[model samples]
Target: MRRNRLLSAVVAVCATSALGFTVPQTAAADPGSTACSQMPSDLRPTLILGDTGPAVRQAQCLSNMWGGEPPKLVLDGIYGTVMLKKIEWIQVCHGIPQSGVIEDHTWEVLYHPALDCYLPYPD
Candidate 1:
């Protein structure tokens, strides 16, 4: 009887292990799927010709993401002609449209900063 009980207990343990339970799936599996919806729909560009505040911050962020050599400009939030020129240079280097405006596409590059290849548009 003792040997039979031990064998039965081992069988039960093996059965439970073989039929391992799993937690039910939920919507959290794909976080980015609903990320775009959370953003403001009416968000629009308000680039100032010589205002580099947000633009430069964006550029620096891009620079850091790309692991590229640091840009020669200060991180002041004034988008002056120098910052605009730097933006154009970076865009040209990456073969992006030379809009000289930190638009969505530009912002994508700044945010993602692909290491392998230049991304004209944000993924």
Candidate 2:
């Protein structure tokens, strides 16, 4: 009878332990994973005429990567009409919709010029 009681107690403890334990959940992708997508909305109106210093640098980098040409403009960090024109040119070169806005597709092309032929996944 003592052996049986001990076995029963062991089984009960195991069951209780199992019930208290929980599996941890896996983490999702980082928030910045799709940061490029937000670039359009972030720089909407400013993308038209000109941009600031950092914007100009980003544009120049993108232009150089896409065209394999040296950046002729100065990195004054101003997104002016000239910058807008250049952006349009890039859009034309990449065969993306010429909406005059630096949308997510435009950012992808700018960031990954070498992957011009690659298409982004559907939303």
Candidate 3:
């Protein structure tokens, strides 16, 4: 019984070592971190074409979440066409006008994110 117990312990250790990962000791949200909806206030330069920053990253993250076959944004903070198209899709889904601008309502959708709405727009 002692030999079997030692073998099991060795096997467990070997298996964990083979996995080659360090488990996190603890996890916590940053005290200064803002949620996605609150992300708009962090956006600056109005988040128009060619804009880039933390705010843009925030927008990209939300657009990715808002649901579409929309291309995934890299969160690199650049307001490129991919982000633009995804934002428009989200706006349309939420009944906002399909303007590619990440303005008030668009930002709202990004932050709150659950519009529970989408209309069939003719492509």
Best by TM-score: 3
For residue 34, model 2's alpha carbon misses the true position, in angstroms, by 19
TM-score, model 1 to reference: 0.45
lDDT of 3 by residue, 11-68 (tens): 8778877999542211111213343443545453356778887778877766665443
lDDT of 2 at 36: 26
- After aligning candidate 2 to the native by TM-score, how far in Å is the CA of 31 from where it should be? 16
lDDT of 1 by residue, 61-121 (tens): 3433333443455556567776676566566766788888877666655544445334332
Clashes of each: 6, 11, 1
Question: lDDT of each model, Cα atoms only?
Answer: 0.52, 0.52, 0.63
Q: Specify the poorest-scoring 10-residue window by lDDT in model 2.
A: 22-31
Q: List the residue pairs that clash in candidate 3.
A: 37-111
Query: RMSD per prediction, one decimal?
Result: 15.3, 17.0, 11.4
Write model 2 residue lDDT over 38-89, tens digit each, in one string: 2332452235454455555555544444323323455565666665666666
lDDT for predicted candidate 3 compared with the true structure? 0.63
